[model samples]
Target: MSFRSILHDMKEELGSISRKGFDVKLGHGFRSKSQRVVQDNFVVIDAFKQSCWANMPPELLRDVLMRIETSESTWPPRRNVVACAGVCRSWRETTKEIVKTPELSGKLTFPISVKQPGSRDTLIQCYIKRHRGSQTYYLFLGLSSASYDDGKFLLAAKKCRRPTCTDYIISMNPEYVSKGSSAYIGKLRSNFLGTKFTIYDTQPSNAGAKMTRSRSTRLVGSKQIAPRAPAGNYHVAHIAYELNVLGSRGPRKMQCVMDTIPASAIEPGGLAPTQTEFVNNNVDSFPSISFFRSKSIRVDNCQSEAIPIRKEGMLCLRNKAPRWHEQLQCWCLNFNGRVTVASVKNFQLVASREDGSEHESVILQFGKVGKDVFTMDYQYPISAFQAFAICLSSFDTKIACE
Candidate 1:
């Protein structure tokens, strides 16, 4: 019999039973066997009724599903597209086509947790893409869960207008700004045509709302290179962080080597030039000297008296040498701190050693704690602000963004 005939017969049987008043009740208000059988038949008929949509034309069905997916107004739409794909074979194929379009997939989402105004100890994830035609790069920084698009926007950075400009204005997402506050965080300024740059914290002070260069941390090549040379001409052999200080003679330098050379830039049958070459060429440059405050006091008579003092410890950024990962197919940076290897995504920071062995202890850890939030842990000597800045830097294209 036709589907319509079966459906009609089932409806007629249900109506006839209702009109007959054949309400047979079992013990404790349970339905009688006859009622149960009728209910089961209804369920079977309903299942067939639901299957009618399965015969819909592929194009029409896909259009309906696409509407449902796009109707979600939030970043990382709440309706799980991947889950929808699992419903049937046709849906899976259609989902693949829908997601491949750049309009749907190019953007990323991250959940953000902002504890207070100007808080730096927050976890952020950055997505970076380089546009070769424009010779520029774009960064989408956010907090997200499961690497899905349900990300909350935090900050964004783009190259300045000038073609030779290496400066990028790192701005706060307007949606995150309060009524009276400005959306400016700071600027990433490069010195030698992307060879070196400083992260200038331009956050306004709470009391005066004045824009001050609160803290400046520098990232530079380990060996000095001429300012005029194209940055890509030489691999980013070594990258260092120059810690910001207060009333100090100069910033302290902590350096690490990086295999930042792209495979395309590698010369055939030869390694990149050694650091020794740059050292030899710049020997005439004068190095700044630092002066330490005297801790000892001079006695009234003439003798010098030594004072009992607590030892001051230095804070450093320590990590193991970044290694290439076959699965990730990108270099991995593992730190010797609270962060576990699993929490790290995209890349990490590993400590370099003189003896050429990896360091097992981590000095700082920036790990995800929630869908839109991350935690920062660091030992003394590294302020929360400095650690936060370092984490933010991770979201940019290390070589090009500099």
Candidate 2:
């Protein structure tokens, strides 16, 4: 079908609407609202078309809003709702349900403020109090200042009573800073005294370089400057911990991640005894271990070689984002067991550079997208859970044709 004809057909499908109210068929050889409105009155169609989706139909708006709200999209529905509201009065009424309240969120860094000594509540004291009984939670707390006061950053000492906070993965935008103390970073160090969170600092230079001089020059490249060691330091509990989604913590309750013991797998969580070496030869594929089944894997921060373990009767790998050498088909699982599956999955690997350059990757030569359309950002292997779901959902697809 021609693009125009296909587009026309799609609209015909959309114009048939049964809203909560109007079954009023403004009809006659009228296939849909667009056609009736178009042939009848230029003035009316002009007005209706001008409205776009605003005055069209409440049912349609509800369906669209539901889809947008429930399904995934890069932009916030609030912003889109606001923009659509601006388009026409009907849109404003239809999209009035969009919530635009910005909550406490984003990568956290230091210099958090303490309320005045006599004041009833400071942001830090409030957050600490609210989080008193809390297990790991995903929350955003803001810093009141850009620099520290009297040589100390305020967030430096507000400790979480939960011992688990010590292991909490603290992630932040690399740009947060306290300007005055270039040499006196000791202030920030005190923040970790009572808790167990280790910092995973991202380099500012590593932030996407799509920028102008004004933005690029701001904060003097906050991502790059060497941070001063936090002051009043105690022993570092754990140097590195895996962070879950956007620095979210583990579930409020411990979530169990399960794995199936394939016949070839070795005893569960015991893979070192397996002797499957990393080889590129096409003889045997390394057994696939879905990260979903194994939520977190422990590995040495700095490891020399890939280690294997035997679980069930086969081998299970802890990390999947291996440095794959095509010549040597087997991958080099780098982390000892440190990276979270969510962290690896959520990794924003832009396949192209800011200037729009791309690496040459094997196309794999199949599927809907043309060669090399896949990358860490958009493509992923079939997850173990998905595979199991397919097996359950299928009657014919599961069994291969003889």
Top candidate on lDDT is 1
Q: Point out the worst 10-residue segment of candidate 1 by lDDT.
A: 272-281
Candidate 1, residues 1-402: lDDT per residue as tens digits?
533453355455444554664432222111122232346446522222233343558887687667655654344452255444443345556755664321113222111112111112222333333344443333333334333233444444445533332445444443332111234344444433233334443322122222211112111433223232111111112234443434333212333232221221122342211111011113123232222223331111111112111112211133434566889775545433323334332223333333445344443455443333344443221222233445444433333221
Score residue 165 of candidate 1 by CA lDDT: 29
Tens-digit lDDT track for model 2 on 224-327? Answer: 12233221111111111122335442211110011221222222332111111111111122122232222122222112121122223321212222354678
| Model 1 stretches with alpha carbons more than 4 Å out | 1-145, 161-165, 174-181, 204-314, 323-347, 350-402
How many angstroms is residue 162 displaced in model 2 relative to the true structure, after the best TM-score fit?
A: 15
Question: lDDT values of the candidates?
Answer: 0.34, 0.23
